[model samples]
Target: MQNRFRANARFGGQRAIVALMLREMSTTYGRSPGGYIWAILSPVAAIAFLSLAFSAFFHTPPIGNSFAMFYATGMVPFLMFNDIQNKVSQSLMYSKQLLAYPKVTFLDALIARFLLNFMTQLLVAYIIFGGTMLFFEGTLSIDILTVLDGLLLAAQLGLGIGTLNCFIYLRFPVWQQMWSVLSRPLFLVSCTMIMFDGIPEPFRDWLWWNPLVHVVGLVREGFYDGYDGYYISSKYVMLVAMVCFALGLLFLRRHHRDLFER
Candidate 1:
């Protein structure tokens, strides 16, 4: 009987998550003119612009022969991190009204947004990366496993950080703007275009601690055969993500009521 009840609960949760995802798709994208196409185009357009703008400045991209490949590898992982983090962090605020019902909980909101956005970003990455490689006739060897690993790492980190930030943002609204401002520099410094080894000494030592740098390095390692991302430590990235996720759960469990009231 207990097992049956547990199975039913799990089924119900899956149904709720699917419902939330479909609602989000309809409201967030369906209402928009282009709908799902926008998801594909947004990243494609960004990479195109980055590749074109940087082609002159970088005769040789940090990774492969094609400027598009280099930027896509870097940008896609970074975008995955950025998008998932932002979406998860805002899940509470976005679904506050729905949370009033007994059927929905904060976890449901987080899971819904996390699953939807992660899959969307993953699809976008595959399309943009695969298309760029075919179009440019990229000579570099693409390590599919490493690319997936990098993206998975980015998603995990994003979920952890965003979960923590969700509670923080709820308790203190101003922190949202503050975090936005603070994260602005991340785009420039996250090795979106530049290689980790390319950075001069001393700085590389400090920048190595930033997880996104390692994530970008992993993506680049997958894209380019000769390039080595020996500096990346998956353990370190996993550690940071787990710690943040645990802390977020701790705080949220304790203070969720206050957040809901606010």
Candidate 2:
């Protein structure tokens, strides 16, 4: 019975995923000099740079008086999405050697990387956001539920986009470079530096098409009681995420063998 249980694909897949996550932790973080500390600090340092660069210009953030708090709200989710997307896109490639084993499926690789990276980002976001509220001189009223929703939506978006890109990267290696270049503009327009309403009318309407704007708005809603972000639509973000994820799963299911061959 014990042996039979291990042979079941569902049971075996879970075990395989856990094992892969453990392997990734050691190889990805455990071997590094700063290890996980860097994960927490990288975003902090980036936020610090943003604060310094912009402080020379604006006396206060468009919405929040504290620039650090404002950017942290936006940057954490954006970074989470970026990190998860990059990590998930490379998941199968990173563990290509291990995929040779029959029990280890590509799904296992995706699941493992998504889980590990999402959890890591969550912890880092919590630490950064919590510390900012505690130490920074600002009034931040946190709605934990809203923050969780924003993070969840960000993770979902990342996983969905990354899953699709994983197959794309496998099929067309040049796409990797192309995507990196394209994503450069995301940081500038992701509402990290400013709020959704802060943008001019036509631009704000156009920017609403980007689901990330909604996620950031939702996050800020939780922080500021007077913040007016009734325009945020969680359903739209979920729909986009679901579509991408469904398409990714469909493509991977159909052409997984071809992906390996390429």
Candidate 3:
């Protein structure tokens, strides 16, 4: 029975993937009052609040008139990562009933959650960007392509971490809670609100080694031309993301059966 079920659990075509993603999306936010609107609004509000708070404390603009823009670029991707991690960590427990279905593999849940968060993040980022550009008359550039590239990198980073966490959650349920506690402070160190250039040389070098910092630096490069002077290693970021992805897949493949039992 287990072998047969595994055989039937391979990823299906685009149509099946789309249907599964939609089902997961609806199940995730549809029961609430605002449903999908809340998903969009919550991140926007958080970014705005963070921008305001930081703007006051720093006593200087973080990114010129584009402080909100800077914050949005970082916040949207970080929130997407956090959301995917949270959703994927609990995916097995939430989809325990659906696991009985032959088509709904453990991977499908992770993929669906990742896709949903990716789409939602992209939508929110664009909306905020567009509104800021129009209303605030912010500086515009032809670097939109770079922004897209950065978004892809962010998505890869999120998907890689989220997939690994799925396996960790299945193997050790306590890891989910532990991860939440550890990730909060790490967000501050991620160079989301502050530019890599702002840090002292020694700490700046250390922050440059962080993959999340590279991701943010890449996004900033797309937004501001001068940002390339900072120390960002896109190759390092990609390598880290790829390593996480490969290890996560191996872990999942080896322990998939264990997930079903738990």
Candidate 4:
């Protein structure tokens, strides 16, 4: 009986997760004129704009095919992380109505938003990858695994930050606004636009501690051999993600009741 009850609980949770994801999807695109087309096109357009802007200044040769490939690998992941973080931060407040339902918890709302963002971002990454290969005739290599690793790392990092943000936003609303303002400069310095290898030695060593830099460098390793020697410790990245995830969960578990009371 206990096992049966546990199974049913798991099934119900999965159902709720799916329902929330669909709800978010409809609200995000269904109401818009172009709907899903905008989600697909937005990233592509950004990649194009960034590629042109960077190429004009840097004059770097194409690593795989065109500048698009280089830019997409870094830009898409970073943008996805940012999008997920923003959405997850706002998820609790946005889904307050849905939370009235007994089965849907605040964490479910976060997971639903993450799922929506993940699916869209994964599609965008593949579209850009396919488009680049088609245009430039670049061969797909084993390094593709690194891209997958980076995606997972980014998701973990986003979840940790998003979960913590949820609690912070509930406890102190001003932090949300402050976080928005502060994240921009941090994004700029995250080595998304430029390769870590391109940075001078002393500065690069100092910046190595930034986990996002490691994430970017790891992704770049799959594309360029030059980045293979870059000093990004994947172990450290994983450790940080684990710590943040644990703390976020603890905070949420302890304060969730208090949050709903407010």
Candidate 5:
């Protein structure tokens, strides 16, 4: 009886997740004309613009011969982290109405949003990176495994931070704006456009704390064979991500009822 009950619970969770995914898709992508195509285009356009603008100023990229590829290496992973984190952070708020149903859990909402956004970002990354490599001449010396590893790290970090933010966001309304203002400098310091090696002085020591820096560094290391990502500490990034994720879950579990009542 217990085994049967477990199976039924698992099946019900899966069903709830699927339903949330469909609802998210319709609400998010359905409103737009192109639906998913805009997901591909938005990143492609940003990458192209950054590549062109930077190429004009600098003769060559920080490491690679192709600016588009160089930027894509950084931008895609960063954007993936950005999109997934934002999506997952908003999951609870978006699905609060559905959570009234006994079978629909907060976990289901979180998973549903994360899965849909992660898959979409993964597809976008493949298309953008593949297109850049194919059109550009020369050897990028791509290591597929290393690249995948970096991307997975990025996604994990996103999930962790996003999970934590979900609780904070609902609890404190002002945090939403505060995080936006504070995180603005992340793009400049995250080792996206600039290599860690190029950073000189005590500032480099401080910037190393940002988990996304480690993520961007590892990703660039994958794309550029010659570039060594000595600064990337996967362990450090994982620690930060895990801590945040755990705290987020704990917070949600303890206070979700209070929040729902409010």
Candidate 6:
């Protein structure tokens, strides 16, 4: 009887997640004109502009022959992290109405949002990276497994940070704004388009700790065959992600009801 009950609960959770994903698709994208296409175009346009604008200043990209490929390697992972983290951070508030249903718990809301956004970002990365390789002078060879590893790390880090931020953003509304202002520089310092080793001194040491930095480095290492991102510590990235995820669940389990009551 206990096993049957557990299986039913698991089945119900899957149904809840599917319902939430469909609702998000309709409301978030369906309402908007050119809905899903916008998801691909927005990132593509950004990469194109960045590639063109930076190419003029520097004779060549920091890594690959094509500016597009180099930036894509860096930007794709960063965008994956950025988009997933932001979406997951708002998951609870997003599915608040649905959560009133007994079968749909906060975990369902969190997982639904995370899964949708993570998959969307992966698709975007695929289009951007694949299209770049076809049209541009990208590296001849690629390491698919290495790229997958980096992308997975980015996804994990995003989910972890997003989970933690969800609780904090609800508990202290001002933190959302503060985090926005503070995180703006992440794009600049995360080594999205720059070579990490070339960076000098105390600044490099500080950036070493930013998990996103490690993610970007791992991704670039995947794209460029000869380049070794020796500084990247996958274990460190996983540790940070696991720690944040654990703390977030602990805090939310204790205090999530407080938010619902408000």
**Could you give candidate 1's per-residue lDDT for residues 78-176 as a string of tens digits?**
999999999999988888888887777788888999999999999899888889978984566778999899999999999999999998998889999
Kindly indicate the candidate among 3 and 4 with the higher TM-score: 4
User: lDDT rank, highest first?
Assistant: 6, 5, 2, 1, 4, 3
Q: Per-model C-alpha lDDT, please? A: 0.88, 0.88, 0.73, 0.77, 0.89, 0.90
Which lDDT tens digits does candidate 6 get at residues 1-262? 9999999999999999999999898998899998879998987888899988998999988777898888888889999999889999999988888888899989999899989988888888888889999999654588888899999999999999999999999899899999999999999989987889989998899999999899999888878888989899999999998998898999999999888898
Q: Against the correct fold, how does model 5 do in TM-score?
A: 0.97
Comparing 2 with 3 on lDDT, the higher-scoring candidate is: 2
* lDDT tens digits by residue: candidate 3, 116-182: 7788778877887787667653666738887787778878887777777778888888998898898
Worst 10 residues of 1 by lDDT: 56-65
lDDT comparison, 2 vs 4, better candidate = 2
Model 3 clash tally, residue pairs: 0
**231-259 per-residue lDDT for model 4 (tens digits):** 87878878887787677778887987688
Residue 44, candidate 1: how far off, in angstroms? 1.9
lDDT of 4 at 222: 75
Residue-level error in angstroms, candidate 5, position 23: 1.2
Clashing pairs for predicted structure model 6, backbone only = none
Please report how far candidate 1 places residue 36 from its true position, in Å: 2.0
Q: Which prediction has more favorable lDDT, 5 or 6? A: 6
The segments of candidate 4 whose C-alpha lies over 4 angstroms from its true place after superposition are 62-65, 137-142
Whose lDDT is greatest here? 6
- Backbone clashes in candidate 6 total 0
TM-score of 3: 0.87
Q: How much is 244 displaced in model 5, in angstroms?
A: 0.6
**Which digits, one per residue and each the tens of the lDDT, describe model 2 over residues 219-241?**
88888777878889999998988
